[model samples]
Target: MRRGCPVVAEPLDTQSLDAAGPAPPISEADRSPARAPFDDLASDWRLRHLLDVDTLSRDEILRILSTANAMAEVLERPVARTPALRGVTVFNLFYEASTRTRSSFELAGKILGADVINVSGSGSSVEKGESLVETLNTLAAVGADAVVMRHPASGAPWLAARTIGGHIINAGDGQHAHPTQALLDAYILLREFGDLGGRRIVIVGDILHSRVARSNIWSLTKLGAEVTVVAPRPLLPVSMTAGAAEKEHPLSLPNVRVESDLDEAIVGADAVMALRIQGERLSGKLLPSSAEYARRYQLTAERVAQAAPHAIVMHPGPMNEGVEIAVDVAHSPESRIEAQVSAGLAVRMAVLFLLIRGGA
Candidate 1:
């Protein structure tokens, strides 16, 4: 049976459902022009590559979100395919294993009529001793118009953008940034709460190793959201704290505050995002027993009630049910987790359309 979200039991599991869930039927309102202030169909998109959320300004971020709204309308249509990216050759170069991200990117590209090619590290020349630099250069040499890459290293996309001729979209780069995930997350919130300014957003979980948390910090703070990052002392990175210097943690803006108490931080939150525990990235025991961690951090139904009455629960999946988030909470009416995946498709389609065809 097709589930609502493609979230699997683990992030490394390659057998998850396709991230593009069934599209909602189009409505009369969906056919209308986007209501965002900026014109999403404009031909003035300037960024060549989406390497990080830090590179995007408030206006640019809004533009992308607005464009995604238009893309959503397309998704609801009888025939969801669009010719916006026709003749474009897009390459998904994933060094790390992924299910949601990889599947969504591929679906997004195909839906936009791009010639999508997927290349995994193990399946590609990287397994046969090809260097990252060589692999990136090779994709460029083969006429890739845009390359979506997920790597184990933090600044791999930046390196690829420098080395390759095509555009570099950071799928997820180690503990650095997952820009698109942040965008889709923001999209979900924007749809729920029109204005993010002065909104309280609580992020709970393994903050130290989560690229999702890092990316969310940049995007949410930029949009004037009051972001509270809650985690255990070990799981919380010193770089993301307010006490850290600007030069030390440039992306950790003034709107963000660190908290050790999930319940305390979640109070009056407009949204609560529980990040996945990045087990593969952990080394030398950053966490205690999983049971202990769950007791301290799991987003349960009771804790969800502590937030604002309309507060939405979010997760950048493959979720560890009963670990980072409780099973019922993941499927709760207030949970926007499934919608986040759907929004990812539209957001990615917008990204590719704007980058390749320069919008509608």
Candidate 2:
């Protein structure tokens, strides 16, 4: 069934079938010069490689999302499964505990017709001292075609991608990049604003430990969006990630900026993304207090409006509603947090299609 507006679920195993409306269909009239047929196609292809978000270029990213748009169509069909990835083996190997990301990756694989295997940290062989690389090799040895991984370490996705031959899609890594999250975020921006190019999008909260923030920064900027990172001084790292440095990412790409004041950052922005402050990452010196962080960095209704009238509010998931956002502000039509979740499935499906179908 087509589900919508992904929220942070804690192994509920129950799905909401009512959230999504049906997708637009590929029609003979859709052949009009304005429409891309793939945007309406109901079936999907398999993707093989998912090593890293950086592995995808702008054109590649567009194509992957277009494919995902089609996969979104399949959600409403009588039978959700297609032969797009029949017989393909995809493994969900997560060393860290996750709810939505893990479930969505599993859902994407199944919806695209790939056999799915979910391996969690608890049941996995980590207690035996088998390194991540060795565990990945074991999966490959058993005929795995792709590995979707979430590790506690940043850059683990890239390392796994290099270490393993199959597509290594990063679910989430330590304070590095969550490529799929970025793709979904970009898709939401694209779906709403048409193009993120030259648009000002501000991300507030914990930039220091957010993989979502890092990936979204890189992805949005590559698409020509003007991006800014706003947080207390404590939320930002002393340096950029290895991925950003490796690319020699010029400031002009996203016209990136860093600010200490959330109020100032929201002023004149087209969009504002509020990031969650992980309780786990907070240390002795990083924050004065959660209450203080809430007061200083939170996106209130007044703050959200401080941006351009066209600005939309966003969050990756598991929102500290009372903390990072006012409850009234989270459900505002301008907030695309739910849309981001929907787009996530579409984006992941696209990545899988591209890698498995090898860009049919």
Candidate 3:
């Protein structure tokens, strides 16, 4: 129930759960190839299923990354179309409003050679009793093999993934995990730094409300990158993700440091990812103002320089310039904002290709 809290089908075995707070341990099952479950998907892009990160072990994570890296190659090619998912019918069932995520996913599906359709709740059957599951079922009946979904609820994708016959790829689910965003960000780092192991990276700004931050930490630290989370106490989640995945949380990483001091967090870091301050979730008397937050935690040039000179700046799409980062510097070459977007499509295409091909 991490993303907007989808109803869980079964109660978790709490006794077996690791008592550690948000960001649980990375299972050896999840470790990159050496593990067999995921190794098979490496060559088989037709691998279906985008249920939850919990189900796919670490090696699967690397398998998808390897698959996504290949998808990225498609983006670099002329016209960027592959028959991998050719003629596969797919659906974009977005219960939440989005501009870039929806567009990128639809573009990714089209590029990977799949038939795409978009559905929004604003003026659709969803206005009726059609639950998220109900609508998705209808899509499946109509021949959809995959769904790139964005919902206001956190665990919506997980619930839908189980409810539908087709595979589910979470676009942005509440403040919960955004797997593709995490994957693309990881891809950007992989392309830049080679391997994430031992690299120092800091994610500054709204950790609690930014799904990007949550998902990024899991992928980043898993590959051996050092992580740091800097945010105001109120803005950060009182409790982060729990259960077996605890080790992946940014705060739990052995080398990761949690600091309220923005400047200190960024100092000498290899990369700094600034998450847009989500004003919607801010409750009574929390943050002062956009201007105030910008002045304090905002990644202006001065604060960035306080960190290592080599540190690169990152942000997810539709950035709140004055709020989380300064407008002038957000577009710099070192800023992989757009690159992150491009990689998102490639990685998502990889996810879809796996699911659709398998389901087909």
Which candidate should be chosen as best, given TM-score against the real structure? 1
The local distance difference test score of model 2 is 0.73
In order, what lDDT does every prediction score? 0.79, 0.73, 0.69
Best candidate per lDDT, number? 1
Better of 2 and 3 by lDDT: 2
Task: Give each model a TM-score.
Answer: 0.85, 0.83, 0.81
Per the 3 Å backbone cut-off, how many clashing residue pairs does candidate 1 have?
0
Pairs of residues at least 3 apart in sequence or in different chains that clash in candidate 1: none
Instruction: Mark the regions of model 1 whose C-alpha exceeds 4 Å error after superposition.
Output: 1-40, 240-252, 280-284
Candidate with the larger lDDT of 1 and 2:
1
- Mark the 10 consecutive residues where model 2 has the least summed lDDT: 8-17
- The TM-score between candidate 3 and the true structure equals 0.81
| Model 3 ranges with Cα > 4 A deviation | 1-47, 52-55, 240-254, 281-283, 358-360
- Taking the tens digit of each residue's C-alpha lDDT, what string does model 1 give over 1-360? 121221211111212112223233445453444432122364687788898899998777876766676676666667877666767899999988899999999999998778999999987799999999998888888899999999999998888988877888999999889999999998787767666778999999888888998889989987878888888878777665557642232343677777788878888899999988866533347775778878888999999999999999999999999889999999999998888888899888878877765521
Sorted by lDDT (best first), the order is 1, 2, 3
